[model samples]
Target: MSPTQASRPSTGRAARPLAALLLVAGAAHFARPRTFDAIVPRSLPGTPRAWTYASGVAELALGAAVAAPRTRRLGALAAAGFFVAVLPANVKMAADWRHRPTPYKEIAWARVPLQLPLVWWAMRAGRKV
Candidate 1:
Protein backbone atom coordinates (compact mmCIF):
# COMPACT_ATOMS: atom_id res chain seq x y z
CA MET A 1 0.00 0.00 0.00
CA SER A 2 1.06 3.58 -0.58
CA PRO A 3 2.01 5.97 2.23
CA THR A 4 -1.29 7.79 1.93
CA GLN A 5 -3.40 4.65 2.06
CA ALA A 6 -1.32 3.13 4.86
CA SER A 7 -1.83 6.17 7.01
CA ARG A 8 -5.53 6.65 6.39
CA PRO A 9 -7.14 4.26 8.85
CA SER A 10 -4.91 5.22 11.77
CA THR A 11 -5.83 8.87 11.57
CA GLY A 12 -9.48 8.57 10.55
CA ARG A 13 -10.40 6.48 13.55
CA ALA A 14 -8.81 8.96 15.89
CA ALA A 15 -10.47 12.16 14.73
CA ARG A 16 -13.92 11.88 16.32
CA PRO A 17 -12.78 10.92 19.81
CA LEU A 18 -10.02 13.50 19.71
CA ALA A 19 -12.43 16.20 18.59
CA ALA A 20 -14.97 15.32 21.28
CA LEU A 21 -12.33 15.27 23.98
CA LEU A 22 -10.95 18.62 22.91
CA LEU A 23 -14.42 20.14 22.90
CA VAL A 24 -15.20 18.93 26.38
CA ALA A 25 -11.80 19.96 27.77
CA GLY A 26 -12.19 23.39 26.26
CA ALA A 27 -15.62 23.77 27.81
CA ALA A 28 -14.29 22.68 31.17
CA HIS A 29 -11.46 25.18 30.98
CA PHE A 30 -14.06 27.90 30.62
CA ALA A 31 -16.53 26.56 33.14
CA ARG A 32 -14.47 24.88 35.87
CA PRO A 33 -12.70 27.90 37.31
CA ARG A 34 -15.76 29.80 38.53
CA THR A 35 -16.50 27.16 41.16
CA PHE A 36 -12.84 26.88 42.09
CA ASP A 37 -10.14 29.28 43.23
CA ALA A 38 -6.41 29.56 42.64
CA ILE A 39 -6.58 27.91 39.25
CA VAL A 40 -4.80 30.58 37.31
CA PRO A 41 -1.30 29.60 38.41
CA ARG A 42 -0.43 31.93 41.25
CA SER A 43 3.15 31.98 40.09
CA LEU A 44 2.22 33.92 36.99
CA PRO A 45 2.62 37.21 38.86
CA GLY A 46 0.14 40.04 38.87
CA THR A 47 -3.57 39.51 38.34
CA PRO A 48 -4.18 36.40 36.26
CA ARG A 49 -7.94 36.60 36.22
CA ALA A 50 -8.13 37.91 32.68
CA TRP A 51 -5.59 35.39 31.49
CA THR A 52 -7.79 32.56 32.63
CA TYR A 53 -10.76 33.81 30.67
CA ALA A 54 -8.69 34.50 27.60
CA SER A 55 -7.16 31.04 27.69
CA GLY A 56 -10.58 29.51 28.09
CA VAL A 57 -11.89 31.37 25.08
CA ALA A 58 -8.90 30.34 23.02
CA GLU A 59 -9.39 26.69 23.99
CA LEU A 60 -13.03 26.80 23.01
CA ALA A 61 -12.28 28.34 19.64
CA LEU A 62 -9.51 25.84 18.94
CA GLY A 63 -11.73 22.95 19.95
CA ALA A 64 -14.44 24.07 17.58
CA ALA A 65 -11.88 24.57 14.86
CA VAL A 66 -10.55 21.04 15.39
CA ALA A 67 -14.00 19.62 15.00
CA ALA A 68 -14.54 21.23 11.63
CA PRO A 69 -13.35 18.91 8.87
CA ARG A 70 -12.07 21.65 6.64
CA THR A 71 -10.06 23.35 9.35
CA ARG A 72 -9.28 20.42 11.60
CA ARG A 73 -5.57 20.24 10.80
CA LEU A 74 -4.86 23.84 11.61
CA GLY A 75 -7.12 23.65 14.62
CA ALA A 76 -5.39 20.54 15.91
CA LEU A 77 -2.03 22.21 15.57
CA ALA A 78 -3.35 25.24 17.40
CA ALA A 79 -4.82 23.12 20.15
CA ALA A 80 -1.60 21.17 20.60
CA GLY A 81 0.35 24.41 20.75
CA PHE A 82 -2.10 25.73 23.28
CA PHE A 83 -1.59 22.70 25.47
CA VAL A 84 2.15 23.21 25.39
CA ALA A 85 1.77 26.90 26.09
CA VAL A 86 -0.34 26.24 29.16
CA LEU A 87 1.97 23.62 30.64
CA PRO A 88 3.68 26.16 32.82
CA ALA A 89 0.43 26.52 34.72
CA ASN A 90 0.60 22.82 35.45
CA VAL A 91 4.17 23.07 36.61
CA LYS A 92 3.32 25.98 38.85
CA MET A 93 0.45 24.08 40.33
CA ALA A 94 2.64 21.12 41.16
CA ALA A 95 5.38 23.30 42.56
CA ASP A 96 3.27 25.42 44.88
CA TRP A 97 0.94 22.53 45.75
CA ARG A 98 -1.78 24.64 47.24
CA HIS A 99 -5.56 24.52 47.60
CA ARG A 100 -7.39 22.70 44.87
CA PRO A 101 -11.01 22.10 43.99
CA THR A 102 -10.06 18.53 43.17
CA PRO A 103 -7.60 16.23 44.86
CA TYR A 104 -3.96 16.95 44.21
CA LYS A 105 -3.35 13.48 42.82
CA GLU A 106 -6.12 13.77 40.29
CA ILE A 107 -5.21 17.28 39.26
CA ALA A 108 -1.48 16.90 39.21
CA TRP A 109 -0.60 13.31 38.39
CA ALA A 110 -3.54 11.89 36.46
CA ARG A 111 -4.21 14.97 34.44
CA VAL A 112 -0.57 15.30 33.56
CA PRO A 113 -0.67 12.03 31.67
CA LEU A 114 -3.75 13.17 29.81
CA GLN A 115 -1.68 15.88 28.20
CA LEU A 116 0.33 13.27 26.32
CA PRO A 117 -2.71 11.69 24.76
CA LEU A 118 -4.18 15.09 24.00
CA VAL A 119 -1.09 16.08 22.09
CA TRP A 120 -1.01 12.80 20.22
CA TRP A 121 -4.71 13.01 19.47
CA ALA A 122 -4.38 16.50 18.16
CA MET A 123 -1.60 15.41 15.82
CA ARG A 124 -3.61 12.41 14.69
CA ALA A 125 -6.70 14.51 14.15
CA GLY A 126 -4.68 16.85 12.04
CA ARG A 127 -3.47 13.96 9.92
CA LYS A 128 -6.95 12.59 9.35
CA VAL A 129 -8.12 15.90 8.02
Candidate 2:
Protein backbone atom coordinates (compact mmCIF):
# COMPACT_ATOMS: atom_id res chain seq x y z
CA MET A 1 0.00 0.00 0.00
CA SER A 2 1.01 3.63 -0.54
CA PRO A 3 2.16 5.95 2.25
CA THR A 4 -1.16 7.82 2.19
CA GLN A 5 -3.18 4.66 2.69
CA ALA A 6 -0.82 3.36 5.37
CA SER A 7 -1.18 6.53 7.37
CA ARG A 8 -4.95 6.73 7.24
CA PRO A 9 -5.88 4.25 9.96
CA SER A 10 -3.29 5.44 12.50
CA THR A 11 -4.47 9.01 12.41
CA GLY A 12 -8.04 7.90 12.49
CA ARG A 13 -7.34 6.41 15.89
CA ALA A 14 -6.84 9.88 17.30
CA ALA A 15 -8.90 12.09 15.02
CA ARG A 16 -12.24 10.41 15.56
CA PRO A 17 -12.10 10.61 19.33
CA LEU A 18 -10.76 14.17 19.37
CA ALA A 19 -13.57 15.28 17.08
CA ALA A 20 -16.26 13.55 19.06
CA LEU A 21 -14.98 14.77 22.42
CA LEU A 22 -14.79 18.39 21.30
CA LEU A 23 -18.28 18.23 19.81
CA VAL A 24 -19.85 16.89 22.98
CA ALA A 25 -17.85 19.11 25.30
CA GLY A 26 -18.65 22.16 23.23
CA ALA A 27 -22.38 21.45 23.27
CA ALA A 28 -22.28 20.72 26.95
CA HIS A 29 -21.02 24.24 27.48
CA PHE A 30 -24.43 25.47 26.32
CA ALA A 31 -26.72 22.60 27.21
CA ARG A 32 -26.07 22.76 30.95
CA PRO A 33 -24.13 25.97 31.01
CA ARG A 34 -24.63 26.53 34.68
CA THR A 35 -22.21 23.76 35.40
CA PHE A 36 -19.60 25.57 33.38
CA ASP A 37 -20.66 28.90 34.84
CA ALA A 38 -19.87 27.73 38.32
CA ILE A 39 -16.34 26.77 37.39
CA VAL A 40 -15.12 30.01 35.88
CA PRO A 41 -12.59 31.81 38.01
CA ARG A 42 -13.74 35.22 39.21
CA SER A 43 -10.23 36.55 38.62
CA LEU A 44 -10.76 36.32 34.87
CA PRO A 45 -12.19 39.23 32.96
CA GLY A 46 -15.77 39.46 31.75
CA THR A 47 -18.83 37.64 32.99
CA PRO A 48 -18.44 33.94 33.63
CA ARG A 49 -21.37 33.11 31.42
CA ALA A 50 -20.00 35.18 28.58
CA TRP A 51 -16.68 33.38 28.77
CA THR A 52 -18.67 30.19 28.77
CA TYR A 53 -20.28 31.07 25.49
CA ALA A 54 -17.04 32.13 23.90
CA SER A 55 -15.33 28.92 24.85
CA GLY A 56 -18.33 27.00 23.63
CA VAL A 57 -18.07 28.58 20.23
CA ALA A 58 -14.36 27.79 20.17
CA GLU A 59 -14.95 24.19 21.05
CA LEU A 60 -17.70 23.81 18.49
CA ALA A 61 -15.46 25.16 15.77
CA LEU A 62 -12.43 23.17 16.79
CA GLY A 63 -14.52 20.04 17.00
CA ALA A 64 -15.68 20.40 13.45
CA ALA A 65 -12.25 21.29 12.14
CA VAL A 66 -10.56 18.42 13.90
CA ALA A 67 -13.11 15.98 12.57
CA ALA A 68 -12.42 16.89 8.98
CA PRO A 69 -9.37 15.08 7.60
CA ARG A 70 -8.40 18.11 5.56
CA THR A 71 -8.17 20.28 8.65
CA ARG A 72 -7.09 17.73 11.24
CA ARG A 73 -3.48 18.86 11.39
CA LEU A 74 -4.28 22.42 12.35
CA GLY A 75 -7.28 21.36 14.36
CA ALA A 76 -5.14 19.06 16.46
CA LEU A 77 -2.73 21.89 17.22
CA ALA A 78 -5.59 24.18 18.16
CA ALA A 79 -7.12 21.51 20.29
CA ALA A 80 -3.86 21.13 22.17
CA GLY A 81 -3.60 24.85 22.61
CA PHE A 82 -7.19 24.95 23.73
CA PHE A 83 -6.45 22.38 26.39
CA VAL A 84 -3.57 24.47 27.70
CA ALA A 85 -5.62 27.65 27.50
CA VAL A 86 -8.28 26.21 29.80
CA LEU A 87 -5.88 24.92 32.43
CA PRO A 88 -6.42 27.92 34.63
CA ALA A 89 -10.14 27.45 34.62
CA ASN A 90 -9.68 23.84 35.60
CA VAL A 91 -7.45 24.88 38.47
CA LYS A 92 -10.00 27.43 39.61
CA MET A 93 -12.69 24.84 39.40
CA ALA A 94 -10.74 22.50 41.62
CA ALA A 95 -10.02 25.18 44.19
CA ASP A 96 -13.49 26.72 44.20
CA TRP A 97 -15.21 23.42 44.68
CA ARG A 98 -12.74 21.96 47.13
CA HIS A 99 -15.07 22.42 50.07
CA ARG A 100 -18.24 21.40 48.38
CA PRO A 101 -20.10 18.08 48.51
CA THR A 102 -18.58 14.68 47.74
CA PRO A 103 -19.28 13.92 44.08
CA TYR A 104 -19.31 17.51 42.96
CA LYS A 105 -16.18 18.37 44.85
CA GLU A 106 -14.43 15.26 43.63
CA ILE A 107 -15.37 16.02 40.10
CA ALA A 108 -13.98 19.52 40.46
CA TRP A 109 -10.68 18.29 41.80
CA ALA A 110 -10.55 15.63 39.16
CA ARG A 111 -10.70 18.21 36.42
CA VAL A 112 -7.43 19.73 37.55
CA PRO A 113 -5.21 16.81 36.66
CA LEU A 114 -7.47 15.58 33.89
CA GLN A 115 -5.88 18.15 31.63
CA LEU A 116 -2.73 16.07 31.52
CA PRO A 117 -4.21 13.14 29.68
CA LEU A 118 -6.18 15.49 27.52
CA VAL A 119 -3.10 17.49 26.65
CA TRP A 120 -1.19 14.33 25.98
CA TRP A 121 -3.88 13.03 23.73
CA ALA A 122 -4.14 16.27 21.82
CA MET A 123 -0.40 16.48 21.26
CA ARG A 124 -0.02 12.88 20.25
CA ALA A 125 -3.00 12.98 17.97
CA GLY A 126 -2.49 16.48 16.64
CA ARG A 127 0.78 15.76 14.94
CA LYS A 128 1.25 15.59 11.14
CA VAL A 129 -1.75 13.28 11.10
Candidate 3:
Protein backbone atom coordinates (compact mmCIF):
# COMPACT_ATOMS: atom_id res chain seq x y z
CA MET A 1 0.00 0.00 0.00
CA SER A 2 1.12 3.53 -0.74
CA PRO A 3 1.86 5.88 2.20
CA THR A 4 -1.38 7.80 1.63
CA GLN A 5 -3.51 4.70 1.47
CA ALA A 6 -1.87 3.30 4.56
CA SER A 7 -2.35 6.52 6.51
CA ARG A 8 -5.99 7.03 5.61
CA PRO A 9 -8.79 5.53 7.69
CA SER A 10 -10.36 2.30 6.51
CA THR A 11 -13.38 3.11 4.33
CA GLY A 12 -14.43 -0.50 3.83
CA ARG A 13 -15.34 -1.07 7.46
CA ALA A 14 -17.32 2.12 7.96
CA ALA A 15 -18.79 2.69 4.51
CA ARG A 16 -20.19 -0.72 3.66
CA PRO A 17 -22.68 -0.85 6.53
CA LEU A 18 -23.89 2.64 5.72
CA ALA A 19 -24.18 1.67 2.09
CA ALA A 20 -26.28 -1.35 2.97
CA LEU A 21 -28.52 0.75 5.17
CA LEU A 22 -29.02 3.25 2.41
CA LEU A 23 -29.89 0.54 -0.08
CA VAL A 24 -32.46 -1.03 2.20
CA ALA A 25 -33.94 2.32 3.16
CA GLY A 26 -34.15 3.46 -0.43
CA ALA A 27 -35.80 0.22 -1.46
CA ALA A 28 -38.34 0.66 1.29
CA HIS A 29 -39.13 4.15 0.08
CA PHE A 30 -39.65 2.91 -3.45
CA ALA A 31 -41.88 0.11 -2.23
CA ARG A 32 -43.77 2.19 0.34
CA PRO A 33 -47.21 2.58 -1.16
CA ARG A 34 -47.45 -1.09 -2.03
CA THR A 35 -46.27 -2.43 1.31
CA PHE A 36 -47.55 0.56 3.29
CA ASP A 37 -49.72 3.61 3.00
CA ALA A 38 -48.49 6.92 1.66
CA ILE A 39 -47.17 8.97 4.57
CA VAL A 40 -46.01 11.88 2.47
CA PRO A 41 -47.62 15.27 2.86
CA ARG A 42 -50.92 15.14 1.00
CA SER A 43 -50.76 18.91 0.73
CA LEU A 44 -47.56 18.80 -1.35
CA PRO A 45 -49.63 18.54 -4.50
CA GLY A 46 -49.05 16.27 -7.49
CA THR A 47 -48.29 12.54 -7.27
CA PRO A 48 -46.15 11.19 -4.42
CA ARG A 49 -45.19 8.05 -6.30
CA ALA A 50 -42.78 9.84 -8.62
CA TRP A 51 -40.96 11.64 -5.85
CA THR A 52 -40.58 8.51 -3.75
CA TYR A 53 -39.19 6.45 -6.59
CA ALA A 54 -36.81 9.16 -7.70
CA SER A 55 -35.41 9.63 -4.23
CA GLY A 56 -35.07 5.88 -3.82
CA VAL A 57 -33.09 5.54 -7.03
CA ALA A 58 -30.89 8.44 -6.03
CA GLU A 59 -30.23 6.96 -2.61
CA LEU A 60 -29.45 3.54 -3.98
CA ALA A 61 -27.00 4.96 -6.50
CA LEU A 62 -25.36 7.29 -4.01
CA GLY A 63 -25.02 4.52 -1.47
CA ALA A 64 -23.29 2.32 -3.96
CA ALA A 65 -21.06 5.16 -5.06
CA VAL A 66 -20.06 5.93 -1.50
CA ALA A 67 -18.99 2.33 -1.04
CA ALA A 68 -16.44 2.82 -3.82
CA PRO A 69 -13.32 4.70 -2.70
CA ARG A 70 -12.95 6.69 -5.89
CA THR A 71 -16.43 8.18 -5.65
CA ARG A 72 -16.80 8.50 -1.89
CA ARG A 73 -16.81 12.30 -1.73
CA LEU A 74 -19.42 12.63 -4.42
CA GLY A 75 -21.41 9.92 -2.76
CA ALA A 76 -21.20 11.66 0.59
CA LEU A 77 -22.52 14.84 -0.99
CA ALA A 78 -25.31 12.90 -2.61
CA ALA A 79 -26.20 11.25 0.65
CA ALA A 80 -26.26 14.59 2.43
CA GLY A 81 -28.49 16.03 -0.27
CA PHE A 82 -30.77 13.02 -0.06
CA PHE A 83 -31.06 13.37 3.71
CA VAL A 84 -31.86 17.08 3.45
CA ALA A 85 -34.45 16.53 0.77
CA VAL A 86 -36.28 13.86 2.73
CA LEU A 87 -36.23 15.76 6.04
CA PRO A 88 -39.34 17.68 5.16
CA ALA A 89 -41.26 14.48 4.87
CA ASN A 90 -40.43 13.71 8.46
CA VAL A 91 -41.29 17.23 9.57
CA LYS A 92 -44.57 17.11 7.69
CA MET A 93 -45.42 13.79 9.25
CA ALA A 94 -44.89 15.22 12.69
CA ALA A 95 -46.52 18.61 12.17
CA ASP A 96 -49.63 17.45 10.36
CA TRP A 97 -51.93 16.71 13.27
CA ARG A 98 -54.57 14.97 11.20
CA HIS A 99 -52.18 12.90 9.08
CA ARG A 100 -49.88 11.19 11.52
CA PRO A 101 -48.40 7.92 10.24
CA THR A 102 -48.87 5.26 12.88
CA PRO A 103 -45.42 3.65 13.01
CA TYR A 104 -43.62 6.82 11.98
CA LYS A 105 -44.15 8.81 15.17
CA GLU A 106 -41.03 8.00 17.15
CA ILE A 107 -39.08 7.61 13.96
CA ALA A 108 -40.06 11.00 12.58
CA TRP A 109 -38.85 12.65 15.73
CA ALA A 110 -35.75 10.52 15.86
CA ARG A 111 -34.68 11.59 12.39
CA VAL A 112 -33.92 15.17 13.35
CA PRO A 113 -31.24 14.13 15.80
CA LEU A 114 -30.04 11.15 13.85
CA GLN A 115 -29.51 13.00 10.58
CA LEU A 116 -26.54 15.05 11.72
CA PRO A 117 -24.62 12.04 12.99
CA LEU A 118 -25.38 10.02 9.89
CA VAL A 119 -24.21 12.83 7.65
CA TRP A 120 -21.05 13.27 9.67
CA TRP A 121 -20.38 9.55 9.64
CA ALA A 122 -20.77 9.39 5.88
CA MET A 123 -18.46 12.31 5.32
CA ARG A 124 -15.85 10.92 7.65
CA ALA A 125 -16.03 7.43 6.21
CA GLY A 126 -16.02 8.67 2.65
CA ARG A 127 -12.85 10.66 3.18
CA LYS A 128 -10.98 7.64 4.51
CA VAL A 129 -9.22 5.19 2.24
Best by TM-score: 2
Candidate 3 segments whose C-alpha is farther than 4 A from its true place: 1-8, 34-37, 42-45, 97-104
lDDT of 3 by residue, 1-129 (tens): 999888777877778888888888878876675431254666666677766776678878988888787887779777877777667776665564345565666666776667788877777767745
Candidate 2: regions farther than 4 A off: 2-9
Stretches off by above 4 angstroms in model 1 are 1-7, 10-12, 35-37, 43-46, 98-103
Q: Could you tell me which residue pairs clash in candidate 1?
A: none
Rank order (by TM-score, best first): 2, 3, 1
What lDDT tens digits, residue by residue, belong to model 2 across residues 1-129?
Answer: 789868665766888898899999999999989989987878889999999998999999998988888988888889888998999998888888778889988887888788888877777676763
Better of 1 and 2 by lDDT: 2
Per-residue CA lDDT of candidate 1, range 1-129, in tens? 788787567554666676676677667766776522355666566667567667767877887887778888898898888878777766665655656555874667565556777787788778742
Model 1 TM-score is: 0.73
Q: Cα lDDT of model 3 overall? A: 0.73
Please state every model's RMSD to the true fold in angstroms: 3.5, 2.3, 3.4
